[model samples]
Target: MKALILVGGFGTRLRPLTLSVPKPLVDFANKPMILHQIEALKDVGVTEVVLAINYQPEVKASHSQISILQLRLCLLKKASFYFLQVMLNFLKEFETKLGIKITCSQETEPLGTAGPLALARDQLIDGSGDPFFVLNSDVISEYPFEELIQFHKSHGGEGTIMVTKVDEPSKYGVVVMEEETGKVERFVEKPKMFVGNKINAGIYLLNPSVLDRIQLRPTSIEKEVFPQIAADQRLFAMVLPGFWMDIGQPRDYITGLRLYLTSLRKKSPSKLSTGSHIVGNVLVHESAVIGEGCLLGPDVAIGPGCVVECGVRLSRCTVMRGVRIKKHACISNSIIGWHSTVGQWARVENMTILGEDVHVCDEIYSNGGVVLPHKEIKSSILKPEIVM
Candidate 1:
């Protein structure tokens, strides 16, 4: 069946990384974040995908073109397209080389998730009148899409939402389902309290009729459309197996990378160590180097051209391209973005996330803090707080 992916959100919450690149293009597990979603959908027998993109359409177009080219090289080809780039050269190359057709649509203004569905309704629906899957580009789950589809079909549900257990239901669209039948009894938008732990995982198997509920203007599918359907008692819920991590925040983004790396290690022993001891779980791009006397982790990612100096300790840290960690620096549970430099003897700890080109001077200690992209932190210290 076909799938519709909402990738148009500006991703204001994930700044710096999303400043130049769309949120879907942000790297997670050594690949673009949206690639994981696309791959998952493909795993579930989805042959066609419709991307809804708004921010940085040109870059998104180029990235999709490159991905299509790579997929053709690897024989994982399927129908895909960036929402824009109907007139670009890359689209021509994509059409010629991949032998797959791509369609594009533009949103002149901001349209919420469901609004895009309304915009692309004619293109997405086929004559068969079948349901199509809808995905949020930023949510990454290794859940079995095929099984979720089965759950929807067997129960004759108008819509089936993939649900997962979370510690805080208040942060998401919480679902209250009947235990025996998996029927969605109620939909609560970030309720203050909850009796169950199940929450909306942002993955849906939606019937085309749901698209009619979405207005032509900006409207939240979660807040407006889904609740109305749940009230009608037609919504179904499915619990999925395997790991799922939303890459909306810096910490969750880093965690998603680590989780993907771990999954990779299980499939191949020679893969980078999900732990530092194994060569496989650690991914050091060809141009990156780990210096002597450094204790790298069970889960570490050293991006292209990065350098880890002597005596530096990094565990569960992701060092993006061209980052330089000087001698005697100690970093753990953090993510250091591209071209950022850590001063000698600097100490960063406890889930600190440093954006691109961030300079942590010598002896500066930042813990549980976030450093926005291209910012300067010189001769000073920051504590455990949100950096951006």
Candidate 2:
């Protein structure tokens, strides 16, 4: 089987992190974010994975915005080459790392979600009428793909969408599936009233023929394609049994990290750190140097080459690779990105997200701060703010 992974658009929700790299390339645990989805696809007899991307926008330039148009044209000329180079490197690394044949299907103009399928028509079409997998790149989940395929095959539908139950259905695109037949009846995107608990999980097993219905224009699959298919009674829903997280934003990325680690601890306990005072469900990479007398845990991930000094306390934080935490520092609900330095007697807490190569001087205290890359923070931040 083949798969198409949607990786288009600038990830605006995850700024600074997405500013430096694409959302798919952002590190989740120790691996690039999209590797999880690619690995899952590889497990289910999938060989080639096509990345559907929008390299340029479709809008025609207006004379009133000539400067903006000029800037965009310049960026469009350069950005595609840079993106292709990064894609090449990522493809090479992932092929070696995960052993999958990855390829790209770039769109000259921005194609909305669901439009990419029609845009990549020649690449995805097969005469044998086989089904293909389509997934959004931002989701991180314990994808029970084998079971999903089995369910789709038995359901006898043109499409089968993977759905998962959410507590707050109003905030997401809720899927209303008939309990008996498993057929999708309706979709409520951010509904004001109580609709249903199940929401679209951003994964789909789509028949190749489904592309025949889509046009080569900006279109939303959720709003356009899905509703029509549901009305035709050819769309079905398969509720996933395990965990799912949409890690498109910074806060959810941390939450997804916690969920992933929690799941790993159940099936693979050896993957987590093993040492003194390691409080709960922690994953310290093998190369990380954890000092004695440190209290870590309740969902903490210390990446490779990290050095934690004695008497340090960490909880619900991701300390990325090459970070050095000096003595008596405390961190909670934060992310210290790659190669950052937190000094002695420092305290970082309350959802602070520090990008790569940041420095926290000794005795500094940062609370709910968003520090960008390569910055040196020297003062205390009691409230949430961005430190450029």
Candidate 3:
């Protein structure tokens, strides 16, 4: 089987991190975010994976056709090139590592959720009539790809969406389906009133014929294509069994990390860290150095080349590659970006995010501060704010 991941252009929701690295390349639990999905797809016998990325057109003064938004996107031209280069290199490495044929499907114009499928029609359609998987890049879950495919095949529908129960159905696109038949009756996108507890989990298995419903333009699958499929009685849904989260923002990313660690502990306890200094579930990379007397636990992931000094405490956080936490520093509920430094006795908590190469001065305290890249924080941030 084949798969396509909708890796939209410039992940603005995950800024600072996305500014430095592409969203797909951003580290989640010491591994690139897209790697998780790719690995899952590989496990379910997916041979080729297509990354549907948006291509920004160059700015031309003579062209009156360009909109203000397109002009603004042109400003990121250099950065976009860099992102593509990095992504290609990463894909090359993973292709060999995972033994999968991974390729890119670049869209010259902005194509919304469903349009990418139409744009990459040639790559997906191999004349086998086999269903291909479609996934949103930001979503993290214990991917039940095998079961999802089985369910989709059993329903004999053109498309099958994986749905999960959520508390606030109004905040998301709710899927209303027959409990017995799993046939989708309708989709309610952010309805003011309660429709159902189940919401789209951003994963789908669709036949090649489903691509015919989509046009090669800026079109939403949720708003346009799925409704038609449902009306034709060719759309179905399969309930997801485990945890699911769209880690597209900082807060949700941290929350997703905790959920991931908990699931990891149950699935593979041997991978988790264990020692006198450890409190709960913790993941320390083999290259990371943990000094004596440091207390780390309750959902913490220290990436490769990290150094946690003596007396440092960490909980419910992700310390990315090459970060250093000096002696007596305390960090919780936060993300320390790549190669950042937290000085001695410093305290960072409550979703404090330090961008790449950021340095927090000794004896400093920060609460819910989103520090940008290559910055130095000398003063304390008492409240939640962005430090650009």
For model 2, how does the per-residue alpha-carbon lDDT over 52-111 read when each residue is reduced to its tens digit?
Answer: 977564445566765876867766656655766686687787787677778888887666
Best by lDDT: 3
lDDT of the candidates, in the order given: 0.72, 0.86, 0.92
Which runs in model 1 stand beyond 4 Å of their true positions? 54-106, 190-194, 265-269, 274-281, 359-364, 368-377, 384-388
Candidate rank order under lDDT: 3, 2, 1
Model 1: residue 189 alpha-carbon error in angstroms: 3.8
> How many steric clashes does model 2 contain?
0
Best by TM-score: 3
TM per prediction: 0.78, 0.93, 0.96
Tens-place lDDT per residue, model 3, 3-94, is 99999889988877887899999999999999999999999999899999886777766558767877775778877888988998888998
- Candidate 1: tens digits of C-alpha lDDT, residues 260-373: 677766665464633333333677677777777677775778887888888888777788778899999988778787789999888888878777788888888887767787
Model 3, runs deviating above 4 Å: 62-72
RMSD of 1: 9.0
Using TM-score as the measure, name the better of candidate 1 and candidate 3. Answer: 3
Residue 137 in model 2: lDDT: 93
**Candidate 1, which ten residues in sequence have the lowest lDDT sum?**
75-84
